[model samples]
Target: MYNPVRRNRNIGTENQGFGQNNRLQISTPYGTLKSFYERIEKYQKEVRIINDHEFLFIEEETRENCHHTCTFDDLESIIKQIPKEDYGDLKFIILRQPKRKEEILSPV
Candidate 1:
């Protein structure tokens, strides 16, 4: 009756009750990014999946919470592309971006 697999599954289920939310939360040091959030912009957040290794979330409207990346490698280039004013506030929780089949195939 003492099955290791069963026990692990039960333990995992119980651990789920810990109220863990795996979403990323980023903050900036200089507040240059904060100014972008003052007025509402149309593109608040955009999530992009780079290849299969990493993902990123870009908050266009708000500078204070402008961007987040699941992994650094996936977003290094994208991060550089962001205006210096908005890069300071970036933070992230580990996650992968979902992509549409067509979007992935579309010519960039």
Candidate 2:
């Protein structure tokens, strides 16, 4: 797993939110692109950018919460994945399907 640089300036432990301690506690967002690609290369997933409009990647079924939308990760992550300075016009090609059940001819 790739751990991003953690700055202690404004972080709170235990997933705290606003108004509880008068501030929000969140993980530091945006790591270096080198760290980002290191993660990708470690997983050996393929990626491609099309016409500066679409970004595509293949990921394995590893995390319980991960899906095709890639929302658990944020736009800070989106740039590393999409590599776009301006991401408003980017279109997506999501291709993920539930695994098909295997046939059981015999229960033995």
Native-to-model Cα distance after best TM-score fit, residue 5 in candidate 2, in Å:
47
Which pairs clash in model 1?
24-93, 26-91, 27-89, 28-89, 33-63, 33-64
lDDT (Cα) of model 2: 0.43
Any residue pairs clashing in model 2, and if so which? none
Model 1, runs deviating above 4 Å: 1-71, 96-108
Overall local distance difference test of candidate 1: 0.43
5-104: candidate 2 lDDT, tens digit per residue: 7554446765545356654322234765442123332132444544455455545454466555563234325565654555666544333333222112
Candidate 2 to truth, TM:
0.20
TM-score of each: 0.21, 0.20
Q: Please, what are the lDDT tens digits per residue for candidate 1 over residues 1-108?
A: 677666434355667545467543333347466532243344434454433333344433323533443444555566656665664544542332222332344322
Error of 2 at 81 (Å): 22
Off by over 4 Å in 2: 1-19, 29-44, 47-62, 69-108
